[model samples]
Target: MTIQEIVDKILAYHPDIGDRRTCDVIVGADPNRECTGILISIAPTVPIIRKAIEIGANFIFVHEPTFFSGYDDECEWLEGNDVYEEKLALLVDNGITVYRDHDHIHAHRPDGIFHYMMKHLGWLEYLKPQARGWEVVLPPTRLGDLIAHVKERMGLEHIRYIGDPDAIVS
Candidate 1:
């Protein structure tokens, strides 16, 4: 399928849900170009782009921006910079098309990122979906223990918590 078709399908599947606008856009290549394969990534770094090319993938659906900024605007100061040129060249040379999926993914039903994380970390059973994130009432556990549980479950090496350690969450 063509990159345009993929973009259309993706937008249809996860259309702008609320007041937020989607950042999804074909950042590189012609939308009509036929796709060899697709790559999904949180961020399309130089290495990721290279790997995609090596694997014959021409389309990337990224969660973040291809350019340095959040809005994916080209940095003016970096126009003549080597890093920017190399990164841009890599995508252009390989005929890769990048589409950012940030806004829609976050606005998705049950919140895509949160739901995925909770499901993967075995915390789905405890998730009580709120407006933005899950809300849960624990069984009178200490704050430190609760934090430790989350850290261990999420495979986090470090975490920063707000509020008192001895304070009850629920």
Candidate 2:
């Protein structure tokens, strides 16, 4: 199906009781809306947008705004206080329409992003308490080894740790 059609169907499935703005982050199609590929993601960050382009996904169906609003998606008096105006400009220049699916993905069976991500991590079951992220049954691992392993696995440039980096977690 086309992008517009998908967006409409997404809005029609808002599960929240008082959820009014289900279209908060619904972006758009390509310039001609004839994109060869589609990419669904949690947000339209500059990195993710660039990745979409690199992966040949001309259409980006994001769950969040391309530009950060500083506040929690409310572009009120804090409208122009975003630090991502440049990213917005890039989207326009690249003919990318970014929409938020914050509710759309979450409204999926269980967590959309979480479920999507879980597949890669090989997690069959998860203890997903609301507010808290996840508790997967992982093999025993050392903190340092796990941290280093993760850093290498994701190819991250830098990682920040808050807890005692040396202290081990069982």
Candidate 3:
């Protein structure tokens, strides 16, 4: 499919005509298109943007802002923001197409990201994935073992903590 076809598919999945100012359905490139290698990312950063170029990715689907912050704020476009500027420049210069799947991907019953994470972590059968998060049906295990398992499975350096590390989290 071409760019137009891809865009149509996306809209078909999530038909909400949202405000452009919101990042809900921002397309850094064209919407309707088919690309050779599509780049999927959770956020758009300088490295991620360049990585797309290095990989010769014609289509990019990013989860976060390439220029702005927050959910829907019109991105700050001033030149003072060096990092953001560089990222945008790469896209413009290379004619890369970028799309954010925030609104559409989450529309799936379990959300694409949830299923992706679940599958990657080998927890699909044990968890009900949702757009917001997930629920896991797990057998009994030691708290320390559980923590270590989660940390290793997620490859997380530091997970958010409401209390001390030694505090048992359920």
Question: What TM-score do all the candidates reach, one by one?
Answer: 0.77, 0.59, 0.69
What is the full ranking by TM-score, best candidate first? 1, 3, 2
Which scores greater on TM-score, model 2 or model 3?
3
The top-ranked prediction according to TM-score is 1
Candidate 2: which pairs clash?
25-99, 25-100, 26-99, 26-100, 27-98, 27-99, 63-101
Local accuracy of candidate 1 as per-residue lDDT tens digits, 44-110: 9988998899899999888888877777654676788788788878888879988888788777777
The reply for model 3, stretches above 4 Å from the true place, is 14-22, 27-36, 71-73, 76-80, 125-133, 156-170
Q: What is the C-alpha lDDT of each candidate?
A: 0.79, 0.60, 0.66
Candidate 1 lDDT (Cα, 0 to 1):
0.79
RMSD of 3: 4.1
Comparing 1 and 3 by lDDT, which wins?
1
Q: Runs in model 1 with CA error above 4 Å? A: 17-21, 129-131, 134-170
Which pairs clash in model 1?
none
Q: Give the least accurate 10-residue stretch of model 3, judged by summed lDDT.
A: 161-170
Higher-ranked by lDDT: 2 or 3: 3
